[model samples]
Target: MNTEEFNNKFDEGQSMVDDLDLSKALRSEQQLTRISIDFPV
Candidate 1:
């Protein structure tokens, strides 16, 4: 393929990776809580 085509594909792939990184960062910023209770029979 030509240089231009290769560059375009590379840019697209890079953008997808960047978006994934951003989503992961955003997910890490959220708060989560869990609780468990047990009962005896």
Candidate 2:
């Protein structure tokens, strides 16, 4: 969909998931990582 249609849908409070490719989408400035930590007394 063009930007105008997408914007209209968003402004109308409609769900936009069906028109989006979320697999490659990420929130701005966010990083995902898996970490492991060990501590010994």
Q: With candidate 2 superimposed using the best TM-score fit, by how many Å does residue 11's alpha carbon deviate from the native?
A: 0.4
Backbone collisions counted per model: 0, 0
lDDT of 2 at 4: 98
Residue 40 miss distance in model 1 (angstroms): 66
Task: Look at candidate 1 and tell me the lDDT of residue 39.
Answer: 96
Model 2 scores what on Cα lDDT? 0.93
| C-alpha lDDT score of every prediction, in listed order | 0.64, 0.93
Which run of 10 residues does model 2 get worst, by summed lDDT? 25-34
The TM-score of candidate 2 is: 0.59
Winning candidate number (lDDT): 2
**Cα deviation in Å at residue 19, candidate 2?**
1.0
Model 1: residue 7 alpha-carbon error in angstroms: 0.1
Best by TM-score: 2
Candidate 1 lDDT, tens digit per residue, 1-41?
A: 56786679787775445324455465565788888999998
